[model samples]
Target: MKKLTRLEKYHMNKVSQRSNGKVVAITPEAMEIEQRAIEREKRGHYRVAARLWLQCMDVASGEVERARIAIRRQQCITWSNHTRQGEYSGIGCRGVVYD
Candidate 1:
């Protein structure tokens, strides 16, 4: 059998506990990540926000928290893709590099 990484082990444990109505308490780091992701999105750093939000999802306390993070991540992903497309089409903003 393949060895399970820490994250994979956590996911497996959560999946098993989920059936027993357990909820994992989120850490302070999870909250920090959520805040950072929000700030990044506000600053139009969609790609960065998307990645942070994905990390946040991994530490989310429950299904609702995960769902909220999922929505934010999806929105950032769409915005990131749109901006990239715009740059590719030579319609980038004046004096603003996408990076």
Candidate 2:
């Protein structure tokens, strides 16, 4: 099993706390899409992860869920190294501009 990141653990804790540790129904399709997005994020493919996060958000069940996914998408976008041509790359978002 992949070890959970700090952010993932934080989300799990808050979600469990919110519902007394009970899980609501999750659509398998949405879960699958979420897994793919997470994998992309772990591989440093923030652009792809952002797209998958948007898809996951579309299938999310409630406002809170959608909001969480939107947060993830935004994080990806921030780290995506936005370019003048309106594209993203794996370049780390540390103020390095690639031409």
- Looking at model 2, report the run of 10 residues with the lowest lDDT sum: 16-25
Residue 65, model 2: lDDT of: 65
Query: What is the per-residue lDDT of model 2 for residues 1-99, given as tens digits with 9 covering 90 to 100?
Result: 467799976665466323432222255667788888878988888999999988887887656666567777888999887533554555776566767
Compose the digit string of candidate 1's lDDT tens values, residues 1-99: 567799966774465422323222245667888788878988989999999989999987566557656776888999998775423424654665554
Separately for all candidates shown, the number of backbone clashes (residues 3 or more apart, or on different chains) is 0, 0
Note the residue pairs that clash in candidate 2.
Answer: none
> Could you give the C-alpha RMSD of every candidate to the true structure, in order shown?
10.8, 12.0
Off by over 4 Å in 1: 1-27, 85-99
